[model samples]
Target: MKFTFRKYERINKQKEIDAVITGGRKFFENGLLVYILKTDRNYSRIAILVSSKVEKSAVIRNKFKRRIREIFRLNKYKIKTPVDIVVVATQISVRQKYKILEESFLKILNQNGILNL
Candidate 1:
């Protein structure tokens, strides 16, 4: 499959985001705050939130967003159900290496029981 995160696969609508924020199950692991809500769609969608409080530099924030997005983009297909996912990064995440970040993300997926193998 082509490695790409399309606009449709992103949780960009305010209503959708708000629903996840208000009702999704929350998980905190490896400096990442994950919010997930089951959806009726055929596929999952994602959003990455990196607040300025996490880092003062826009460059750093964008970089962190890209890394988190990439991690989700690559592993999203493994999810067994359709879900709206929001990944919020904390300050501790900025200092971690890519591998560690990926591991942490996978751990969260595993913990949620959504990861298929």
Candidate 2:
């Protein structure tokens, strides 16, 4: 599988993000928060959010986003459902290792019944 995060696979518009946040089903595990909404498209789209409340530094926030994005990018194929997913980072996320984040993310996907694996 290609390990690329394409533009079509990302939720960039603020209105879309707001809609997902407001209308999606929410799930949380080990400092990782996920909001998932079923979409009309055959493929899934994703957004990664790390607020200032989670970390004071912009660098740290960006790092968190990058890590989450990488995790999703690597495991995107595991998800069978077509949905819009918004991933939010919490304060505890900054301290967790990459493996833990991956596990937490997969747990969320499994709980949502989106993971095919």
lDDT of 2: 0.90
Top candidate on TM-score is: 2
lDDT of each: 0.87, 0.90
Which sections of candidate 2 miss by over 4 Å?
Answer: none
Per-residue lDDT of model 2, residues 17-116, tens digit only? 9999999999989988899999999989999988788799998888888888898899888889899999988899876888999899899899889999
TM-scores for the candidates: 0.93, 0.94
Q: Residue 78 lDDT in model 1? A: 90
Q: Residue 60 deviation, candidate 1, in Å?
A: 0.9
The residue-by-residue lDDT of candidate 1 on 1-117, one tens digit each, is 767888899888888888998999998887878899989999989998888888999988888888888998899889998888988889998767788888988898888898998
Evaluate model 2: give its TM-score: 0.94
- Superposed on all Cα atoms, the candidates' RMSDs to the truth, in angstroms, are 1.1, 1.1
